[model samples]
Target: MRRLSGVTIDCAEPAVLAGFWSALLDRPVSAEHARPDWATVGSRFDPAPRLTFQRVPEPKRGKVRLHLDVEVDDIDEARARIEELGGRWTGERHDYPGEGVVLGMTDPEGHEFCVVQYF
Candidate 1:
């Protein structure tokens, strides 16, 4: 059996990226696993994998294939909150009647993610 341990993100600033993700996920950054160049967040009763951030020297060149999908109760509120936290709405939205809505957004580090709300 394959046990999914964690997902590591290559970033320029570990603490900053970790902080953005931590607030968005409503979880605390794991101090024990954090370092000057690496930081971890999320892992409390959540069956999903944890998130780790590692410091990298190079900037992201192209688009990211793997990004996060954050589910929230309200898309508008979440968008506002994300914007308040330095993230921005990408002006792209998708709607599925009787299903849900997906709002595209970019994090402080320019990583794209989605805020989803299901009916």
Candidate 2:
């Protein structure tokens, strides 16, 4: 069986961007990693894969190709929490007759990800 360990994000500041994701996902960065170029957050407890942030010299351009779909208990509450942690809402929402709602958002580094609530 193939197992996925985590997802790596590319950004200009690893520590700063990692902070936003660490708080949002409720995972602490690994103490073992002392390198300033990389940071990681996540644990086996998390239902999804772990998150890793790597330092890059350039800022992101245009839109990201991959978007993470995060399932939340409450869309509005989750959105609020994201902003409180430094992320912002994209001001876009999609409704599916009986499916549920999806809210678009971006991380501090402008990586696109979605908050999903299924009814």
Candidate 3:
């Protein structure tokens, strides 16, 4: 059997980025792994794969080829909270009428992700 371990995000400040994700996901940043150059959310014991942030030398240059999709019960509320946590709404929204809504968003450092609300 095979399983996924974690997703590593490259950034300039691991701790700060980790903090943002921790707040957004309502998961505690692992105290054991928190550091200037690296930080993580979730642990081996958690069912979900960990979210790891690592310091990188270069700034992000272009649109991310892949991104996270965060599911929420209410997209508007989620958007407000995400902004409070230092994330930004990209002004790109998609609505599927009877299905759901998807909003483009970016983390504090501009890494893209999506906030989704399903009917």
- Per lDDT, the best of the predicted structures is 3
lDDT of 2 by residue, 1-119 (tens): 55776788988888898788878877787743568898878754556677778888887899878888988999999999999888999989999879999999999888999999999
Better of 2 and 3 by lDDT: 3
- Model 3: per-residue lDDT, tens digit, 1-114? 467768999999898898899999999899656567889988857888889999989999999899999999999999999999999999999999999999999999999999
Please provide, for model 1 over 1-119, each residue's C-alpha lDDT reduced to its tens digit, 9 standing for 90 to 100.
56776788988988988889889888888875747998988763457778888988999878899888999999999999999888999999999999999999998888888999999
**Residue runs of model 3 more than 4 Å from their true location after superposition:** 32-35
Cα-based RMSD of the predictions, in order? 1.7, 1.9, 1.2
**How many backbone clashes can be found in candidate 1?**
0
For model 1, the superposed segments whose C-alpha errors exceed 4 Å read 44-46
- Highest TM-score: give the candidate number: 3
lDDT of each: 0.87, 0.85, 0.92
**Residue 89: error of model 1 in Å?**
1.0
TM-score of 3: 0.94
Better of 1 and 3 by TM-score: 3
Measured against the true structure, the TM-scores of the candidates, in listed sequence, are: 0.91, 0.89, 0.94
Flag clash pairs in model 3: none
